[model samples]
Structures are given as C-alpha cells and as structure tokens.
Target: METNLADLPVRIFHVLSRELGRDNLWVKIVDFDQDPIFSMKQLEIDNFLKRDNCCDQVLRRWGNRGQTVGDLLRRLQLLSRTYENEFDSIQLQLRRKFKILRWVPDSEEQVTMAVDEETIKLECKAQGFPCPTIKWYTNDSKEPVHTGRSYTVLRCKCSTEHQYKCVATNEIPEGFSFSEHYKRPGKLWNSVLESDFVDITSLVRDDELCESCKNFEMGRLSQILADDEKVENKTIPVPSNLDSTLRAADKVALIMSNCSYVHLPELMTPHCDAQTLADALQKMNYKTVTLADLTLDEMRYFIREYKKLIGDGVYAVFYFVGHGFEVNGQCYLLGVDAPADAHQPQHSLSMDWLLSIFRDKQPALNLFLLDVCRKFIPYDAIGAFVEYSEQFKKFHRAHRNMVYGYSTSGGVGAYEVKGEINGVFMKYLKNHVSMEISVMSMLHGVLKDIENDPKQIH
Candidate 1:
C-alpha cells in the first residue's frame, strides 16, 4: 500500500529493524525518488540518517518491553547504598505511637499538688523503644507545658494549687482507634484518637456492660497493650485482633522471603522484615506461613501447594522479600540457591508463574506484598532486569480485587534501616497495619505511613 502525496516525486524505503525482530518493519523516505531529470531539490539525507540513528538508540534502550540502563544502575546503587539522593538517618521509627502503659503516674485523677522552687519531677513510665514521651497537662489544657526526657521540670513562682496530669503518648497511627474506643474517626486524617490510660480502679467500678463483655474488652485491651510491649522487644505473639479475625473468618496469608542468596551476602533485614510482617499478619488472624532461605525448587513447590490451604470465603496474601529481577520483561524471584551469575533459568522462580497459581485459586482478594526490587539480572542479551509498573498493573487487572503493594514503586530500590530489624517500608507497615480494618485498608494504612516518611527524598 502507498499514499500519493500530490504528484511529488518521492521514493519510500522499506527499512527493517533487526532489533525489533523480523515480524516488524518500518517505511522510510530514504532519498526520495532522486531523478537526474527536472533538476530535483536535494533531499536532507544527512539529517535523516542522524535522526534514524537516534531512533535506533532509543529502540535499543527501551527494547520491546521498555527497559533502561538506569533501571539496573538504580538496583546496584541501592544494594551498594550509593544513591546520591538517598537520605541517612539513625532514627528508624518515624511518626507512630507506642504502647502507653496505664502507670500510676498516668492517672487522670485530679490532684492538687503544691508548687515551690524545689524542682518537682513527675516521672512517666511507658513501654516504648525510645521510651514514651512525658508531657505535663495543667488544668486540662490541650497544649503541654513541658516535654523533655523522663521528667517535666516545673519551676513554680509561688505557692499555688494546680491540677496537673501527665499524658504519655507515642505516635499512634492515624485512623486507628487504639487510643479511644468511643471517639469517632477524624474527618481530615481519619485517625483514631488515643484512648485514655485505663484506670483499672474506676473502670471495674462503673459496670456499664455485662460482666462478660466488659471482661472481653478489658482482655482485648490488655492484649493490645501486650502487643505494644512485645513489638518493642521484637517478639510479637498472637495478638487480640487475631482472635477477632478468627471469629470473623478472615482470610489466610502465606508470606515468605529468601534473602540468604548463595551468591550474595546474607541480607541483614529481609528475614526480619518477613518475620515482623508475618507476626502482624498473624495478629490479624491470618494463617500465615513465613519462610526464609529456601531453594528455588522449594519455593516453587510451596507456592504450588499454597492454593490448597485457601477457601472461597477468604483472601490470600503472599509476601516476598529478597532479590528480584526480570528476564525479557517477565518478573522472577530469586531463592537462596540463586546464583550470582546466570546459569540456568530454574535457579530463579518466575513471579508470573506464582501469580498464575494465585489466580487459579478460589479467593476474593489475592494480596501480594512484594518487597522485591529489580536487581542486576543476567540475561543472555538483555543486560539488566528491573520491575515495571506495567507488569504489576497488568497483574492487578488479571483478577477482581487482586490487591498488591510494593515496598517501593517500580524501578526503585527499597531503603534499609541500619539499626532497625525491618526494612524501611516494612518498619512502617509493621507499625501501621491493624486487624480492625480490611486487608486492603491495612495495606493502604501502611502505604500512607510510608508516604509520610519525613526523610524521604521524593
């Protein structure tokens, strides 16, 4: 087929791109129909050739699947901790509340304490890693008079009777009603306000509900507080929310990550991340299975059999952490047996293959939390491997309500916290996910926390 551009003497060249494969070709006006007769105008052949070279360079860079050199470089930069734009912080715990203890000092009682020049030190004992911040509230004021270390020092000018209360608060995740069970969700941020420290003396006295219900809530509150303390020590058991999930018939999640690669250095945080996330999942009453340092075949076998554990009434979650790469646009997960160099495709499991298994199962929501990043993949021709937004989006579309979230967006390396046991994203996730919400809501909460990282460089 040809188009006649109004009586002009033009010749079209059938330019075939070898890089684009034999099935695809392009038509170019190489040198027009340069007839010796009629004193034809000279074709801009030099500029045309230069333009073609530029187009070829782009095609080489993007390929058929839109890969780039920067993709691989970003992975290496992250692994080596050499990103110029990346920020460093000794502080890992960003904005999130810790478990506030109902200590005697945290009582909401009205006490008239006499003030003088002798420094009155009110100590607030709370269970948090950095220790709970103690702020003194006088006369029920919203603003605190002091917030420093363990004691809020007050230099009284004269002998005055003052009603002072010590408020102990760590950053509680917004939208979670861990603070107050009765307070409604916030209109702006949707965060649940912190509940007042329980005064066991008064709470047991005012019996509003039947003995059973009150005991349950008190048990649940005790469990929540227990989790708060355990989280600080990095040892979380089946929490209060899990029992509620079991009662509600929540779905099960199978979480696993193999960071101890045979060819790579043992990662300091992936296993910790997997375990912490697993604990959170279990607290949400998910029959979660977390594994570390599995071989390629073992990973495949476990995923293959994972479908049998699911039922139609529940959802499934699969969380992966470790090195990830793509070969020819298909994503793959590396096990501990994965080689540093490309030897055989069997050494790494194709992520698409695992998702295929997930889609085959009967579940309402298939949630996959991928902590994997595109690393230096050794393909025969395609020099690099990296995750793409398109692949995840396509998977998202493959099923109805197949919710998934990554630690970082595609083509970026997830950061690591130096002293913290979990990676950057999981650290926030472990702090934010609540059993009170749906799986998607839990993940959305996690994503919100990650987006709010103060030190994040865009």
Candidate 2:
C-alpha cells in the first residue's frame, strides 16, 4: 500500500501481494546495492490494507497479480492520444501555407499606339491589374514610370528596328507583369560568305575552280622562288579544268539555327518566317523539318533517311533558329531548356556533332543556315556572347563543301522579332522564299536591305 512507483523492490512487493493475497504473497523493498531481507508479513498486510475495486475484484479471483498490468495499459493509451494530436496540427498548417495557381494576363488591356515600319514597329499597350499602382519600363532605359491607380501606356517606339519588351510592377510583393516583345520586321537577312582561298583537296576533279591548271602550275613555281628571295610577292594561280556542270550535280545544302524557344511574342515573327522558308523549300520539292518538330535522335535519323532517299545527287539543307553558345572554341546549338551554366555542357548539342552526321552521308551540297545570334541570355546572372567565330572558321576550313550563313557578321548580335514571328532574320527570308525566290538571290537581297536600314548598323 505504501509502495513508491520509482522503487523497483517496493513495486514488486505490491505486485506479489495482489497475486497470492495474504497466504502465499510476499515481497520486500530491498537495497540490492547493500543486501537486505524481504518479509512476507509486511507484504500481506500492505495488500489487505490497500486494494481498490478494479484490483481487489481481480485479485480475489486471480490472486491480485493483474494490478500492475492494468496500470501499464492505461499509461500507454494516454501517450498514444498525445502523439496523434501533434501530428494532426502539423498537417493542417502545411495545407494552409502552400497553394498552386495558373498565371493570368492583365485585365482592361488596350493598344494605345502602334507605328508600322518595314523591319519593325513602335507601339504601346495599356494594361491594368488589381491593386493598381503600376510602373512601366522598356529595354531602352532603366528608369521606370510609377502611376498611381491610373491608366499607363507602356511606350515602345521601334517594333521594326528590333524587338521591344514592357514590364509592369506593383507595390505588393510578387505582383508584376510583362508584355512579350514585338517585332514586325517583314523580312529577314541571310548572307553567306567564304574566305577567298579554296580547299582544292576536298573537291573532286569535276569541281569548278577560278584558276586554270597552267596558271596554278606557274603560281606554285613563283611561290617557291619568292620564298628563297625573301621578297614581297603575290601569285595568281590559273583556274582548273573542272566543269561547273559536273560540280552542280554534287551540290549539298546545310541549314541550321540555334534559337528555337518561342516563349516571348517577339519571337513569333521570325519563327513564322523560318516556317515560310520551310514551306518554300517544300514547294520546291526539297525535304525540310524544323528542329522543334523533332528530337535530336529523330533529326539524326531523318538526315540519314534523307541521304538514303536522295542518293549521291542529293542537296542537303540544315536550318537552326534558336539560342547558341560557344564553349572551349566550339559552337553549340542550345535546346529549348538549355541552362546558362557552361559547366552543364551536356545540355547543349554541338554543331560539329551535327556536321559529322552529314559528313557520314557524303552529300554533294552542304548549305548551313545559322540564324542564331548572341543576345540577352535567358535566366542568367551574366550575359555575354560566347564568341565562336574562330571555331566556325575552323569548321568552314575543314568542310570545303559547306556554305555558311550568319544573320550578322562575326561578333554581332542577330536581331530578333518582337511579335508573331520569332526571328526578325527568318521573317525576311520567308517573305522572299514564299514568292519563289532563288536561294542565292534571297541571301543577297536580305543582307543588302538590312545594311541599308539606318536603324541596323551591320
């Protein structure tokens, strides 16, 4: 009856007293650390003096051995209830703190002004959001306009010159909206140029050359003599006996661009222009496929299949229209989800890898259309055009059959569209292509037009 719960010997005595009642039950509180005797009389008296209804009823029938068992079961049930309550509270808090919502465009939108130009357009659109207090800014400036609860026209004056973007912000945290850049340049520029020297080794005998064999022989001899003399000298080699007609049968075309993602409206115009070129090629009985429509493996497979179908007389064209970067002196075509980090080289597809695939096919004409220009990097802390012009020059040197076209000269950012067509360069190319324009003429015309435009200094 006076058993201390913390004392093991006393609790044991209480348990034994309940088990055997007064007759056989006996246990004593003993110090195991200092030897002590247990007494039966003490235990019997304790059990008789302090027996409750729950314990006494079971003890009288079952000799009181079940008292400790009833106590342990009740303690465990109380602990389980406490744990359940804590778990429920944690789950409720998580449900209240997080949510997922779809993005919505601003309400009460208006096109305040738009000036149409051949290559671009200048325009403004009024947009209103909840809790007003909106601010506006453009790519041409860092200063923003803050208008309180009033209509604001985001000013953009050059839609044809280049793509323009607008940003709106509010006082509330995480409250902001932006309009996609718009580009209205109706035409795109595609120009291809090669170094003055020719790689005569890569060409077959039937290939055409500007110099004749006799002049080439004389020029080689003059170069050897000039080197011995150490005098400034120039040698003009004669043309080769190669027929231009035979070389025409072995022509191949390669088309490629690196900017493909059309997340912004400014990209639409150029993207459509690229499509127009594809459409033109299709009309001319040439096979064309946009990279967006195929995976890397699929593109490779199609190239192989096309080579098989067209055989030796085939003209192959490859076009690319998306983001590009140069790494370790190598050009890479960035996929839609390409990351900005150069360390993640696995995300990009190498230009050489694509060219190698074509080389395996041994096509006669290799025309490569690269509409990729260095521009504002998507989601990057630093923006710079990873210059790979030297790498391209090396590739051009190695692949004699290749015709390379860049949207701008080396070390220049290519123009992009602000609206419906994704690329400004591709848009112009398509407009001419749709009119049954010849490939060579289209390249020359677009480049000339772009050079003349005062807004663009090429």
Query: What tens-digit string does per-residue lDDT give for candidate 1 at 62-111?
Result: 33333332332222224222222121110111112223344434534322
Q: Provide the global lDDT of candidate 1 against the true structure.
A: 0.49
- Stretches of candidate 2 off by over 4 Å are 1-266, 291-310, 327-330, 342-344, 375-400, 420-422, 431-441, 454-458
Model 2 worst lDDT run, 10 consecutive residues: 175-184
RMSD of each: 31.9, 29.3
- Candidate 1 — which pairs collide? 96-171, 97-170, 97-171, 97-172, 174-191, 175-191, 175-192, 179-194, 179-195, 180-195
| Clash counts for the predictions, in order | 10, 72
Give Cα-based local distance difference scores for all models: 0.49, 0.39
Error of 1 at 24 (Å): 79
Please write out the lDDT profile of model 2 over residues 305-387, one tens digit for every residue. 43432224446676766666444444555554454453233555666666655554444556677776544334342223244
The runs of at least 3 residues in candidate 1 whose Cα sits more than 4 Å from the true structure, single-residue gaps closed, are 1-250, 326-330, 342-344, 375-380, 383-397, 438-441, 452-458
Among the numbered candidates, top TM-score falls to: 1
For candidate 1, the 10 contiguous residues with the lowest summed lDDT are: 85-94
